[model samples]
Target: MNCPKCKSVQIIKYGHTHYGKPRFRCQDCGRQFVLNATRQPIDEPTRQLIDKLLLERLALAAIARVTGVSERWLQMYVFQKFYQTPKAIDVTPKKQVG
Candidate 1:
């Protein structure tokens, strides 16, 4: 098979990945990769559930265990949300009653 990066036919069997997939190294570019690797994306309903859990102030690891998502991904998601939120807010306080 040709190398994905340099499109060169010169490649060698490097080793098996942690997932037991055969990985190849391109001789031209020295890039190693596995073919046909796939990642399943989390669904929208699960995301909504995660949002609700976040509102409840649940622990991140607990959320990851309950939601079947990786803690790293959840942390990145939270970081992205934090940056997307508005910086300023308007608040009005009531005067003290007699």
Candidate 2:
């Protein structure tokens, strides 16, 4: 397939996303783009589901199991707006909680 950046057909498969979508790199412009560029972004249904889980008393692993989203992903997307960066809290560690 041609690259979106350079419109060149010299693109090659670069990598795969965790979601299993193939990533491609443009040889001409050295730009990377997902092969399914036209695919729509994640929908609000998933976001709302995550928000509900965040409000409940469920743990990350418990939420992840029911929602089919990774524990790390659920935490970031749910708490993203509250924190400047998702790394502000470590999901796993021996640190004491304030």
Candidate 3:
């Protein structure tokens, strides 16, 4: 990372801030920087909305507009998580009971 003081690219990760922000230590001139990427995928409010939409079975595009999250990202979460697949009437198999 470039130094915030002198714009040098020599830097290393120190630790974290009080609020748990990533802290970087510059090796070029001994400068510390806190790398805070504000653009997070899902915030607390968005996460709550995600849960609500999942429960309500709402469409991804609509949810994306409301939460500012991409539909593809939402789909990844659904597929990766323990979500049950909706069964089709024609595709569902019949089990034989003996």
Candidate 4:
């Protein structure tokens, strides 16, 4: 089979991936990849839903339960999308006024 990255016919068997999928290395680009990459990316709709839930002030654990996504993944996704970490403001009580 040809290399998917460079479309080169000069491909060599680069052993198997962690899940035992056949991996190939392209001679042209020196890139190694599996035939069927088993990465399941979160879809746009799910991303939007996550953003909505976040805006609604939902707890991370609650959002994870509702969206079926891990809290760590949600945290990383939010950081990547907004280029910043979400933090809550700290409010302190003051003395009562006369």
Candidate 5:
């Protein structure tokens, strides 16, 4: 079989994926792929909804259920977002009211 990325005929058997699907690796570009992929990527609208739900402080399980996404994926996404945020924040002092 040919590599999808580089369209090279140099391909090798890579191991099975977590879901037990047979995986192959391209020797040309080092890309791993399955013959038939079953998992569909989450779309942009669903991602926007997830962001809104995260802002609402909803439980991870609840967000996953509502958005129909795997909790594992949501957790990883949140982990990435957490690290992407600035480490330090500047706060303004509040003025005293009479």
Candidate 6:
């Protein structure tokens, strides 16, 4: 078997997953992964829809429900796509002397 992440052919049988699925490990990248997994990657149209929903300023939960994606994943995606460091704010209170 080959490693999905590194496309390396130096793979060996690892341990079983929690679901009892056979797992394999790649010697080259040291990544252990399962083969013939049922989970599929998100498609382009769905990603576009997520982007559109985000542009509309919808809540993360709402976007996840509409896009069939997890809220945590959406949050990470939004952060990666548009996250910027905010400018520092000065909040020192001035003392009033009578």
Best by lDDT: 5
lDDT of each candidate versus the true structure? 0.78, 0.69, 0.69, 0.74, 0.80, 0.75
Off by over 4 Å in 3: 1-40, 83-98
Candidate 4 residue-wise lDDT, 2-40, digit = tens:
765667999999999878888889999998977753244
Q: Sorted on lDDT, highest at the top, how do the candidates line up?
A: 5, 1, 6, 4, 3, 2
Question: Each model's number of backbone clashes?
Answer: 0, 0, 0, 0, 0, 0
lDDT of 3 by residue, 1-97 (tens): 4776777888888889977888988888898877655344365677787879867767677777777887777766665454355454244323323
Per-candidate TM equals 0.46, 0.41, 0.42, 0.44, 0.47, 0.45
- Candidate 2 lDDT over 1-98, as tens digits, reads 68766689999889888779988899999999886532333346766776787568567788778877766666555555456555656543332244
**What C-alpha lDDT, on a 0 to 100 scale, does residue 88 get in candidate 5?**
52
TM-score of model 1 relative to the true fold? 0.46
lDDT of 5 by residue, 64-93 (tens): 999999998887677667655536544322
RMSD of each: 13.6, 8.8, 12.8, 11.1, 10.7, 11.9
Misplaced by over 4 Å in model 5 are 1-38, 85-98
Q: Compared to the true structure, candidate 5 yields what TM-score?
A: 0.47
Better of 5 and 6 by lDDT: 5
The model with the greater lDDT, 1 or 2, is 1
Model 1: per-residue lDDT, tens digit, 65-89?
Answer: 9999888788767766665553543
Best by TM-score: 5
Better of 2 and 3 by TM-score: 3
Clashing pairs in 3: none
- Stretches of candidate 1 exceeding 4 Å from the true structure: 1-38, 85-98
Report the lDDT tens digits of candidate 6 across residue range 1-98: 57777889999999999789999999999999887532445667988999888678787899999988877677656765654442433433233233
Worst 10 residues of 2 by lDDT: 89-98
